[model samples]
Target: MPDTRHASISVDQFIPAPPAKVWDALTKPELLARWWAPGDVSAVVGHRFHLQMPGWGSVPCEVLEAEPYERLVYTFNTTWTLTWRLVVEGKGTRLLLEHSGFDLDDKRDRAAFERMGKGWQGTVLPRLAEVAAAEG
Candidate 1:
């Protein structure tokens, strides 16, 4: 039996750019394709989009909150609530990512959540830094 506890993933990263630049990489579909998944994403609340997840195919998403250059929250694949909070710090921006609402009771879901956590920390964040830096 898998652990029946709820789980969440959080990551913190500092990019060598302003909040607006980071926000652009996050909100703009073109920049997002460079770093994250390719999708028709917008900075508008309630906007629905799907990202091409390589082997996983298209993952459905919906924008829940869009607060300019400060914060953006969205639903990821109808399972997790992904939140991005940007804060200007000194000469760069601090990016706080929270991917929550994992059902750890199911083994498959738990494994997927763990893999996603690693993917976010390793691939996603680094690509985002590169894109944000290039945009800056």
Candidate 2:
């Protein structure tokens, strides 16, 4: 009748840089690749791309929403959705990430949810903060 599954990961981080710098680090391929996976990503809605995650293979992604220096949303591997929101705080930016749409009942998804949750919290977002703050 209806879907009743809910499993997501949220990563909120503060970067000591302007939204433009943080946005660039999120949208620009060079800067994005430096922290996250490498992809032909653009800050254009509806643009489909692939993020190459070395050992994990290439994952298809599509830009669902893009608001420069404010917000971004995309689909990861068809099912998962990654939504990023940036809020300007003084001269810095408050970065928010929501990685959703996990079918926790499925073993694979559960494993990935746990693994990626760790990855995003432990490595990905911290690196993004560094890369964004370092952007000049």
Candidate 3:
């Protein structure tokens, strides 16, 4: 059966740091530890991570895949895989992220997908930029 239940959300940011530096922020655990989650929340490979917001309950997550200086892919609830792409542009890096393989038939999971979309925009991407700034 052809899978018809895949969903993807993407966002791009141009960071002032070079691609290598930006990539390090994305791939290095020390850098990720600083900006991978929201507020007092934190993250590590193989750790069950969550992002705490004012209203949203802790959003549970795990790091599914990570490739140094190039790509990172991961799953939440074992349902979707989110991939991040970093490319050198001018003196900085153009970061592109894609979240895929969501189950369309499940409404609750769909809500999570929606939240992931917002989180990337409101939380993760900005934090990545911040990490880039701090990387200097």
List the global CA lDDT of all models.
Answer: 0.91, 0.91, 0.70
lDDT for each residue of candidate 3 in 77-136, tens digit (9 for 90 to 100): 456666778888887788898878777788876886778788888887888888887787
- Candidate 3: lDDT over CA atoms? 0.70
Model 1 residue runs over 4 Å out of place are 1-4
The list of candidate 3 runs beyond 4 A from truth reads 38-67
Candidate 1, residues 1-136: lDDT per residue as tens digits?
7555878899999999999999999999999999988999999999999989887799999999999989999998878889999999999999999998899887877988879888999889989999999987
- Per model, how many backbone clashes are there? 0, 0, 0
Candidate rank order under TM-score = 2, 1, 3
lDDT of 2 by residue, 47-106 (tens): 999999877699999999999999999999978999999999888999999999999888
Give model 2's TM-score versus the native structure.
0.93
Residue 72 CA displacement from its true place in model 1, Å: 0.2
Candidate 2 local lDDT, residue 116: 88
- What is residue 8's positional error in candidate 2, in angstroms? 0.7
Residue 55 lDDT (model 3):
53
Query: Alpha carbon lDDT of residue 121, candidate 2?
Result: 85
